[model samples]
Target: MDHPHLPGPAARHAPPEHPEGTAHAATLASFDRGLRREARPDGPGCRVERTGRVVRQTGPRHAWNGILWSGLDATNADAVIADQIRHYDALGLDFEWKAYGHDGPADLPARLLAAGFTAEDEETLMVAEAATLPRRIDLPAGVRLVPVTDAAGVRLVTEVHERAFGTDSAHIGRQLFDRLASAPDDVAAVLAMAGDEPVSAARLELYPGTDFAGLWGGGTVASWRGRGLYRALVAYRAGIAASRGHRYVQVDAADTSRPILLRLGFTPLTTTTPYVHAPATVR
Candidate 1:
């Protein structure tokens, strides 16, 4: 999934504004409140917890665990950070602190670093009005989109993931499988297949009651890049989100996807970096 919380598509919200405009600011504020501060669990065995100024999730080891939102500054940033470290440490869980560009104190990333958290690559937080997106993109010949609904489908997605991103997708597989099993309406996964061989894959996460749905894990193998497979995947999931009543689709996009997303009507609101703290044993 794009985030650790449940995801969705749209609501009847105002049209998007320029990135630096007042309406855009309002959109970001709404996102922070609805998608972050008031986040919900993404799948079975996961729970969202709040501790004063922090909103976080604790889940099974195979699930995403992290601080979704926080209101901290010099006054209590360190103490709260320490508390979180101890909290997850006690559970023997490695966790992430998702720090956004607009997050407080001007030194939160540094604080996370000092506390032994390693920051991964930063991604642009982009959003688009779901109804404004194309519902379909003509696929290249021989490539077809398939909806993922079972363990077999999940395996195909993870297989495409491992090849496209060059990263192990065991965790992603577990999470997707669990979500597919227990919360089918909350997520939609799809694969681009070239005559039975998976080439591209992605998923949409629907957050009911919120105006935003999340687009996650769109990756295509190097050989398949530039064939518009990724764009097709985005359009595919946006169709699902819009049909499901979401007003917007959000994505944590890397460089490769950002340009395409921008061209496809997504506006960058901010950047987010995952600051991860591994369990002592792993550290």
Candidate 2:
């Protein structure tokens, strides 16, 4: 779980210490400790590894593989980065290093670029108390929410995803299908169905033993936008998180979704950018 906005697990690792009173810094710190530093595998066949000052997750090629958390500065940053490159390169896996704006040395992103990693879009790490978010899920006319269970339901979810995002969803389809089959309790996948057609979709990932739940892959087909479908999806998942004793629900939100989430009482915590290195691109 590197990039929060992606359809994947939220990054885990204790966040670096921040100065007090820096606009929700304490909550950000808690998020870092619970999600980043203490990251766990999203599903079966995935493993998290802690090597020295870094924590990384490895899985099958279809699954996410990345460095979730790291402790690096000027002295060890370059060496550690090289080590990770070699490690993943040997395995022939393309991986991501999720760097936060608050991460140390203030030049981690630059170092990553120097190491041949390409930077992706930045996203705001947002969190809200599950109790404080809206709980009533009011869908658009002719739309009803359905819980996704079997492969057929997953197909519907992916259909909406592909229409909304305009990208191939096979990778996400595999991840969601496997997660539903193996650890259904850890996740809640929902689709807004209009008759036999899906108009919107989203999922909630519950982190056991932690107070946070992650909301991922919320999207509505173009025809369904601006009709409260997105808001209903958020409320539905936040309510589920609250029922499960999770105090907070977090989202790695993009510019398009940030204002909507902010209107729903979410607080901006920090920003994260993913640096991806393809094994074939460089050694």
Candidate 3:
């Protein structure tokens, strides 16, 4: 497959420069290489593999299974997609093929839909310079952000996620607990509290070989919306990322958080949608 658009190894290793778009592309390339090179079958039972130009990722059975860092041309797209579906089907694992706007072949999305993959919500790949992100955000007088350090803190984060998203967050809580035990410095979770009650929470995952650190699960309880709590959580995580030598912070922004992320200096580089393939048993 032609990888004309994919960055070469040298480009992936070079230091990123500023202006959000430049940083965004550099960080995306760096992260793609990092995922293929450094991601291991660690805590989340997640493992990555390289097949031809496609990078496949499989995680815990209950969690998401997916593909990443794909660079395919018209000649090979069909075979690559078919192989992925067959491999996952044999393993009885439902998987997602993550398609980014800048990905090659231009018609990969249409092909995926024809092959029985269901498109999920489209999200913006938002990126910002870590140093440019707001460092100090004022929370409501009584509310404060706290770093998660124990099971109680994990539970607090889970509670805020559940309440904010209206769904069970046990899976995320479990992953957070395991990550803390194995690579505490690589990941950090924070919770916003109004005295004893948790109001908002988020997690940051720092990639050692890349310039980007990812922000995930920044959800605030509905009652706490519009109070700057979400932005404060973002500021706190960006500070952490900067302290750890990460040059940029990236988030997969949905409707609720996209505007807030934009206001905080994040620029949308591309849209990504997950094309899911589930076996009949799963469907």
Candidate 4:
């Protein structure tokens, strides 16, 4: 059996940008608002803000995400942040974060470490407002683009991803279909084809809660490489976000494709590194 790593073909992608209030940071701010999607019945659990924590019970099991500032003295900081962690613990979930480096909470890492928490992995946060993005992208020949919203379309996406990312992830197809079937308007998957065959794929998850829509799993087969299909797919996703009132789109990019994202008006806010912690005995 294989252990799960930093979301290889399935992990969510995040990028860091300034506080949403800034003009250059409008996109992230916009998506932040979009994230207030139809809330799940079991979310926004309790928080131990004094301890710097927020936990949601309805999402992934043992999962939580939050931020903190170390400016306060130890007692005050722990009082604030620890209360939040306690809330997450009450929910019986795991806590995690895809934090950026330059964030203001200077002593956040130490706080988390002292609280029995450990850094899972790091990933650079990236952002680009839709207004600042290029609307035009040239698709490589033989690659057909389509907005898929069904099971068959999702299967093709999973297959392309398996080939490109070197992992078997049929679960990815299920997740795509679930999201598409449940919230077609908020999220969309773009498929790039070579004569009816899906050769590349990617997903755009629009977070109306903040000004950030995320780009994830954009994978192209070796045969489909160098055709500009990937960039075209990204543009397609961005178009969807723009249409839905999202102003920014971000991606946690790998070295191979960082150049392409940089060309698309995306600013590298920070570098994100993924660290894995699978048991020595694979589960």
For residue 222, model 1's alpha carbon misses the true position, in angstroms, by: 1.3
Q: Rate the local accuracy (lDDT) of all candidates.
A: 0.86, 0.85, 0.79, 0.59
Model 2, 1-283: lDDT tens digits are 1223432223323333434457477677777787889988997799999997899998888888999888898999999999999988888899999888678666788788888887777788888999999888887778899999999989998898899988898888899999999999999999999998999999999998888999999999998888999999999999999999999999988878888998999877777778899996454
TM-score of 1: 0.93
lDDT of 4 by residue, 1-283 (tens): 1112343332334344444336545543433333322222212232323322322223444222343222345446556556645655665554443334432244545655555555554545567777667778787766678878788899899899888878877767766776776667667888887888888889887765555677888888878788788778877888878877776787777666767777877776554432222222331
- Assess the local accuracy of residue 113 in candidate 2 as a C-alpha lDDT between 0 and 100: 82
- Backbone clash count, each prediction separately: 12, 10, 0, 44
Task: Kindly state the number of residue pairs that clash in model 1.
Answer: 12
lDDT of 3 by residue, 1-283 (tens): 0001222121211222336566566667766666543454435577777776788888776665778768899999988889898889878999999887777777788888778888766677778889989899799999887899899999999999888878888978988898898789889999888999999999998877777888988888889888998888889999999999998888888766877888889877666677789975677
- Over the stretch 1-283, how does candidate 1's per-residue lDDT look in tens digits? 2223221111111223464688688888989999999999988999999998899999999999999999998999999999999999999999999988788867788788889888777777899999999776889999888999999999999998898777899889999999999999999999999998999899999999999999998888879888888888889899888998999999998776778889999998877778889877778
- Runs of candidate 2 with Cα error greater than 4 angstroms are 1-23, 281-283
* Candidate 3 colliding pairs, count: 0
TM-score of 3: 0.86
> Evaluated with lDDT, which candidate comes out highest?
1
In model 2, the worst 10-residue window by lDDT is: 1-10
